[model samples]
Target: MPPLSMPSIPQSAEPAASRHAAPVAKNRRGLETRERVLAVTRGLISAHGYAEVTLDQISAEAGVAKSSLLWHFGSKEMLLAEAATSLFRQIGEELGAEPHHGRTAARRLENSFDRVADYLTANPEAKGVVLALLFSGSVPASVREEIRRGWDSHVQDLVAALSAPGRPLPAPMARLMIATIHGCYCHWYASDRSEPIAAFLAPARELFADWLRSRDR
Candidate 1:
């Protein structure tokens, strides 16, 4: 019987590391490029209005090849829709959940409205998205639908936040109130009026406060 030679210990995973790092680096680059594409799309839509934006422009603004843009998003229309969808999601992210503890719903509503006003005031550039959907109605029906759905969700949250715990306002009035708040926001963006949305909401806020006080009766 002959003794078998001991096998040499395998070296450090440097080869595996080098091989794996390439794909990992490629993935990171892909993610960065994808993010750049979305950012450029958002900015272009924000600045030029969605209807006027083109894939060529988005590609140029993103610094990615136009073919790569197509590879990422398929087409300009899809990219636009996705961009609008993302923007709404971003809005929802900012909204968080309705605060239901400690404070009355009306107070919560007022606080939320203030937050919204501050957001719109600060991001005037994104006002185009709001105005286009609310007033222009010029975007594709699908995009409008997407905005409509997002608006419905946010408004419903407002209604829930404004409702009395067990004695909620009737759906009709709740819907109307939500519309009024949206109208308030639209007025700010569409007309650029400096009436102060926060101030404009004051009367309604007081009305809601009064209603909350009277919920038992």
Candidate 2:
């Protein structure tokens, strides 16, 4: 008798479905956990410096497991970096949305300062973070680098907007214009002012406006 032919074993769709569903489920959980961890980290690190912050503290503050926080950020430095990056990105979005979007370098330059002033007013903790980074030597180099990169990118954008075609201002002067705004904020943060932040920003705004117009001309 001939050997019986073996029947072909067909693959089940169930395994493929399970495999696909597994990653989606995991990713969704991961994103949810990450959001929670970042939320907790921002509150903690903003109120307290990085040195005082720890994974256990974040987990307890966030109501998440320590392992979960670890899975999300891998380390405390990474978490702080994300928070600072988020802050810069928020400011960038507000600045980019201004009437300066399509305007000339001069107008864009003016709007840049105006938008950042508005951001500082709304998010005063941002001022604290800036001061901490500048004055406090304890902040991680990675955090400082992140802020520097953000500042560079923001200046480049203002330059591009201000330097349109034949009317473009010199890069160094444009940078000076941008740096002036940064200096104003830094000074305000450093002062023991009895007045509101708005008061300090008023003169700086006027100065930036005049500088933009004169430089563009």
What lDDT score belongs to each candidate, Candidate 1 first?
Answer: 0.66, 0.65
Cα lDDT tens digits, model 1, 174-197, are 667667765666666666566766
Worst window of 10 by summed lDDT in candidate 2: 122-131
C-alpha root-mean-square deviation, candidate 2:
5.4
- TM-scores for every candidate against the unseen true structure: 0.60, 0.64
Best prediction by TM-score? 2
Candidate 1 local distance difference test against the native: 0.66
Q: How high a TM-score does candidate 2 get? A: 0.64
Stretches > 4 Å off in candidate 2: 1-39, 45-54, 61-64, 68-74, 97-107, 130-141, 160-178
Instruction: Evaluate model 1: give its TM-score.
Output: 0.60
- Per-residue lDDT value at 143 in model 1: 54
